[model samples]
Target: MPDSGEVQAVKASNPGDSQVRVYAVAPRENADPDEIVDGFLEAMTSDDPGFATARKYLTRKAVRAWKPEESISVLTNAPDRDQADRPADESKGRTYPLSGRQIATVDASHAYQPNAPGEYNQSIHVVQQPSADGKSKEWRIDSLPKGLVLGEADFLRNYRSVNKYYFASGENWVVADPVYIRQRQDPVTRMDPVAQTVKALLEGPTGWLDPAVDSRFPSGTQLAPGVTTLVTDDQSTLKVPLNAKADRVSAVACKGMAAQLLFTLGDLTSVRVEQVEIQGSKGDRLCLLGKAQARDEYAPVRNAGHSENPYFVDEHGKLMTLSVGGRQPDRPTEVPGPFGKGVVPLKAVAVDREESHAAGVVQEGRELRVGSITADEELPPAVVTSSGVRPADRLSAPSWDGRGDLWVADRNPVKPRLWMVPGGQGERIEVSTPWLRDGARVESLRVSADGVRIALLVTKDHHTTLQIGRVERTFTDDGQTVAVTDLENAAPRLSSVTSVSWAGPSRLVVVGTEAGGVQQVRYVQTDGSTSATSVLPGLNGVDAVAAPYGEQAPVVADSGNDGIVRLVPGANWQPVVKSGGSPVYPG
Candidate 1:
């Protein structure tokens, strides 16, 4: 049978906070899904990894917010957050997004396109609506099983512009986002006798669920995220915290190992191990590195052309293409199917390792290099729900100059410098940006194939400026040049601006900073003619083309804050990878 599990959601309280959590949960037996949800939230909010919780259901469309005054792009007469009551002179296309909502569930789901032979497009959706007060919400996650794992997504924001781009840098030149990480999802717990009693009854870590001695709640014990047990007292199973053995494997090190592509293989079912492949570290079979851990799960057959799969192949031939390591890319793996509906390796990378190597470094320091996926393979429902990896960072946002090679901002955290890694194996030249800082951030970028034209986004100039420029270097001089540029007063800008693809040879694809679909088309000849619906907008950011997949134009995309992505049924547009929580399985 395939690896299948169930998810459910319930309502609960977080002591002082009035927010209600609709937790997405899955536990073996005699366990509270709520606790697991709470545990996951705690992990996201905390700095220490070892002492936190383990949650596999990070949603695909990462939740976001657009503060009151921060979302205006063309505010001929925009009002401040403190003074807005629907004034008249505001631009119709310039409305700000609400804040404060997040994913309520990240579970698995499946579908069978009869004649087409394809699994359901199992991506995560952050269902949002107006709260009683009018703040935003990413999603309200709750563990729900099978088809119960579904929700309708409404509204999509495509924040795009033409004049500039913003690109945020990552650690060790591995470009990624730093400042705007969302707060964790755990409800706060107060120290009191009732709460303490419930904590003691959890049967977690070292707690024993002995039938003869245990006097705690049965399977129906209340946990966070609003879940209760359907199988209340079949048999009491002890819930050991994920790191009970140790705080070894986590996202941080996993992210590192993801960049470096290290670790060994093991069964993904149980017995969590430490992932380690240090250059000369001692051998410990029990502990494997994070990326390495993901690599071990990539064993599959003819399942051709999967993009989301993480394939592991070390710099050395120590591991080769179709190797477990290659399958686990910069992102952790996800596997979903009827029976096998749990996290698994990204078989896409497993099948396309050599393709990635042809690009550049898949793992180096805190970065993972990934190439475009063009395979026509069918992925398991289990394999489709990996959402925690957002490529809008420095490592992922290399400029697409209409050619094979790419240019990276190399936003390294430790060393504030940029790098130019070719899409293929060439040389990694460190660009000079002596004035950059850890938080300066690269938002978006684009350069000619030969490294000529350039445009990008980054909060520079004392972290208040968003600039767009052209490249002067030809894969030399560290890719530093912005021939013609412009800057605008910063608003809720993009995470990066690689969305600036080529509309045609003459014109370009410009995205936006927020998740809105307000794109205006200007001419490419510099004559600046306007084309309605025929020409896409140029410039801007993360929310630019909300449901971003590829550069194939004349496609309807559901991007922006509203979390909707759509392409024609079989319109040749690439598919998107959604997050998973608990999916229904006939297994």
Candidate 2:
């Protein structure tokens, strides 16, 4: 008989924040049908290596057909098991229905895709079969759903999210591709977390990011045969041994591959990977890269070291800066530009990544002006203008891309369009957005640092939702044609999204509400997944939210009741300015 330890109560924690492991036991001899079903479900949530114990409760045929790794369905809570409507006939079979509210799913690629809460119902059919001794009978599950089913708590406990780095298409900068990996050793591959992350990097980017990024590893490249564990040496260097496919690469490509490993393994806090050394199939060194070198050469947006101070429009409708670091300033200071000098009243403003220039919406949202922040230059002529009569129907807050380009949406319902201003001063180019052709209008917009993704607050059918679209630019003889394509919902759980900003390469901070729920602020991945710790403390009447690229930077927001406030981890929202609005971080 296998040890039948009781299943522990589930405790919610951030993904990758917990290290406790749950062990699963094999089914007891002659277990009844209900017990068999219960044990099977519990086993799926355990750290049982290879799920060998879980398979013991399944019939031989069922074991052959079940593919636990095909996908994972995460429910809001543990599924409820109840007897099916059909009569229980021991010889024929017994059926138990499993029901729950699904919250998200982890596909085969380990990409987490969250959906609005929805009902989930499935069945497990069990039948009595002869024991190994051919003298007794035992209950065994004969049919069940494909893949594994786990509650949100158990899923977070077992698996943790890790960012696998890949280079942006044709760019030296790296982009984060977040995916979940086992917190402990993987049950199926028996590989540790470090090794698992490395393998994931070699497998390439997920489906949603595939078109916008490229992996440095060669095709068919993989860890050497039978190598399932990776660790750092005393110098904090992780040596990755690759198969023959990656044995011969140029110096540049090798560095790119090393940079990917460095960032991916660096996300795992348990491992201190200061350096990464790539090894070829013949055990020869291909390339080596240090953490500092990788950051200087191919750093992600967060590591780019942009200014951390947040900017906001003060009560006087002028751009001001607030320092949220250790020592608070006496009060926010005006920027060194016409918009900051109050030459013209401003509604919204976005500072470039280098903090040298800013773009603002002036003239009651009818005009967008860009000016230098280092000099008190006159606001340039409107790079773009809208004919909409109402301020709400005109221009959105401008956003600066990492490439020094500016993006904004003309909310004029008559001719709604997305526009990009090259160098923040060139002639505005209309970007095509077919999805918005159906009468949807953009309420607000934020461009990612990679210059390839844009987060838009789109309103349609009297409802507003957050959508992420890919910015595809094609060079034509006439010039360059740009289009925003492949839009995906970034926050489906939120019935209405009022504000959004890029918090990280793959994460966005959004202000929205669930169906019939109160307004709230939360962190959402670009892919729409949310972690348990994603929600911040409650704040009332939040109109705009801004998150700096740096992880340690405080999140600033414009609250109607509290004015400008900032939220730091482990602390409540504190007031920054009593009469400020439209807080933003340098894009």
**TM-score: which candidate is best?**
2
Off by over 4 Å in 1: 1-365, 370-396, 400-403, 433-439, 461-466, 474-499, 513-553, 556-587
The collision pairs in model 2 are none
Question: Compared with the true structure, what per-residue lDDT tens digits does model 1 show for residues 225-293?
Answer: 222211111222112122122234444433343232221112111223333332211223222344333
Per-residue C-alpha lDDT of model 2 across residues 1-587, encoded as one tens digit per residue: 75898878975533533666667878888777888999999999988888999999999999999988889999888888997555655588888999999988899999988888899999999888999999999889999988999888888888888889888888898888889999888899999999999998999999988888888899999999888999999999999999999988999999999999988887898899999999999999999999999988887454456548899998888989888865453489998878788888889999998889999899899999998878988777899999998999999999999888999999999989999999999988999998886789999999999887899999999899999888778877888888888888889889999999999778899999999999999999887877888999999999999998878878999999789998877888989899989899988
Ten-residue stretch with the least lDDT total in model 1: 173-182
Give me the displacement of residue 459 in model 2, in angstroms.
1.2
Candidate 2, residue 337: the lDDT equals 73
lDDT of 1 at 480: 36
Off by over 4 Å in 2: 1-17, 85-89, 300-303
Model 1 TM-score, 2 decimals: 0.28
CA error at residue 298 for candidate 1, angstroms: 42
- Model 1 RMSD, rounded to 1 decimal: 27.4
